[model samples]
Target: MREVVPWQDGPDGDADGPLTPSRDGAAKDIRAFDGALGPARAEGLLSALELLRADTARGAQLDFELLRRSQQHTLDAPQPPPFRSLQAFTKGGREHYGIDPTTRAHFDACQAESTTDGGRPLPLTVRAARACLDVCFFHPFDDGNARSAFLVLVFVLAREGVELDGVSLLRRITFQADDPQDALTLARYIDVHLAETRRSAASLGSQ
Candidate 1:
């Protein structure tokens, strides 16, 4: 079952700011994620994610207007570009998801080495989610750090056999954290929360 995206609250219960995903050209790749989707629908989802990412990266906050437009586009309505950006993400959204220039360089360098040095890559859950979080937090590219971080977690969880819905649990944790120190606390909260929720849901056994 799909789970809601997590992490949108802060200790004060006031959001730092809105978050938006950059539209830096991940639309094509986004389609790849939806293997079961019809070609047209997959294309549309990719476009939406791209637009969302673009607005978030540049503005470092959610573009409610862009997101709304993207959703409308998904519904097959004629719409303007959901958002615009200066560029597209490398390896889809992987390159631009985080916040720092130098850190992004290091990540790309490591990824390059991994490509040829391949043994087997780390499982997506273990490696990618953490990677995304590290970049999102450290790079601080002005916006969408939490959302990008959550997307990485979502990808990892999907690889680990979890189906994520729209709400990102990790996103909520990040939003709730007081600062960097509080992020560790949020991580712990997520582990316990998800495990307990799963257990409870399992006990219900499809009613």
Candidate 2:
């Protein structure tokens, strides 16, 4: 994430259009998760959707506070959990995320890349995909890191004035830090979804 990948930009890859709301893919995915695997455990994500929209409107920077707020409802804790201090393991201990003094800072820097810096900007697909991967690799949350990763991906796109009508391609997907192809694959998958979303919205508009 600190080294943002220059994921190739394709025609109309950015989410500057079809801002019109259509089907809520993220919410639908969340609802499915809530109903089946998690029950109300994923309810926080529903609230996070509202938070994402509100934060996007205010142009809030993607940081730890936003992440903390995203988890408040799910954890049912009045006090939001702090940045995870100890190491985090996932995928049945197949993955281990280490932490130290600079871990949170590194995560923050990765979040900052969601916006364009002085350098050339990455495609929205790349940025969003990167955010999703960063959350996965960093494993910032004590629990529900996957949920947070999903929200971060949506938040990154929402920041760029794009909203997907369908997120089934992205929901529940995991990427490996060791695999470079996974990053590119994610960006491409996002491209596919974005194209479909634009087409879907255009069709709805014409009807």
Candidate 3:
């Protein structure tokens, strides 16, 4: 299958830079939001994330069906399953192309690689980030693709017993499908949140 986004090799993709949050302010904001939501009902995206987290904790394997359920929970209506029949596109008019026989095979390969640990030689965070990016670029669902992608990332991390303290950068960020740097950037984003969360917990313990 042809690539949806054309990747250009460069220093950005060549070197694995220091893993840090792209925006420190966003991480702080996410922390504040999480702190404020203590003991409250998680509605909408939060609710769906919580559900997916629980499933992951229960050893749910990451696959297409899990993604469909995530999309179903994310949307108000469940008329359409997670898979998109027609051609979809990003908000910036990046066409996802149509899902034909070739597309299905490509997606299946992605799923298999994502679930199996021996499939890729990359670090866990990078692998998880790649899965998330795959969903974003693939644009599998007719709607809620962004949300679905976010949940997939969370599921990947949770499956490995890694949950972020904050998700500020994970949300509201656009990734270039063709850039290999995007994968590393996302892994760094995850690391930033995890570190911050650990720091926060340590502070609480000392308090």
Candidate 4:
């Protein structure tokens, strides 16, 4: 069942923060495990985990290098990097809308919620993209909100083995969708698209 986390209305009708499994210490531990396992083993473990549609924290538990390797399964080079400082990413997101401190606090609150429970399970591919898109659209930061959120979605989902190109999803959704709602809907469509793509690729290999 989807865990209950109060998602308040984001600024300008956007959705609020994450309310799933916490992963701060767990994420750190995973990184540690990755380091201990070294590159090849870490990558193998991550690849194995991707085949399981489990939780985000379970997957994020891999080491940084392993996480990076897992990311390689889905992402190309020049990946959008996660924000170095949480404060910087949050500040940029809030300032973009010229929001006041109080409202900005709420944005921070939501951001904190996302990280609170390490992360959530993005079982379906499109949902993963949608989560990040929702965060970016609702919390369009002045600095790296879009890029940061995109990276988060990419990395987080990659942990689960949904190796999608963040930029490509953004491009496809923006170009295909007629409106905002349409855009969000298009993101959902990616799930079906990915499944079909994988199926076709497998069939081609068999042939």
When 2 and 4 are scored with lDDT, the better candidate is 2
How high is the CA lDDT of each candidate model?
0.38, 0.78, 0.63, 0.38
Query: What are the per-residue Cα lDDT tens digits for candidate 4 across 1-207?
Result: 012212211111112122122222223332455447566544543443442224354544322233233344323324523322223324334333334445544444443333325454223343444455544544433243443344455444444444431233342243211134443444455444344445555566688
The candidate scoring highest on lDDT is 2
Better of 1 and 4 by TM-score: 4
Clashes of each: 34, 0, 0, 10
Residue-level lDDT tens digits of model 2 in 7-63: 654233774643545877778778886657676666666876787779888989999
Error of 1 at 100 (Å): 8.5
| TM-scores, all models, native as reference | 0.37, 0.90, 0.73, 0.39
Q: Which pairs clash in the backbone of model 4?
A: 21-117, 22-117, 22-118, 23-117, 23-118, 30-61, 31-63, 92-141, 92-142, 93-141
Q: Which ranges in model 2 have alpha carbons more than 4 Å from their true place?
A: 1-12, 15-18
Instruction: At residue 165, give the lDDT of candidate 2.
Output: 75
Q: Which 10 consecutive residues of model 1 have the lowest summed lDDT?
A: 10-19
TM-score winner between candidates 1 and 2? 2
Candidate no. 4 TM-score:
0.39
Q: On residues 93-204, what C-alpha lDDT tens digit does candidate 1 reach at each position?
A: 4454333345544544432321113564432323433344443434333333333444444333333334322232444343221244344444444344344445554566
Question: lDDT value for candidate 2?
Answer: 0.78
Candidate 3 — what's its lDDT?
Answer: 0.63
Q: Which stretches of candidate 3 lie over 4 Å from their true place?
A: 1-42, 79-82
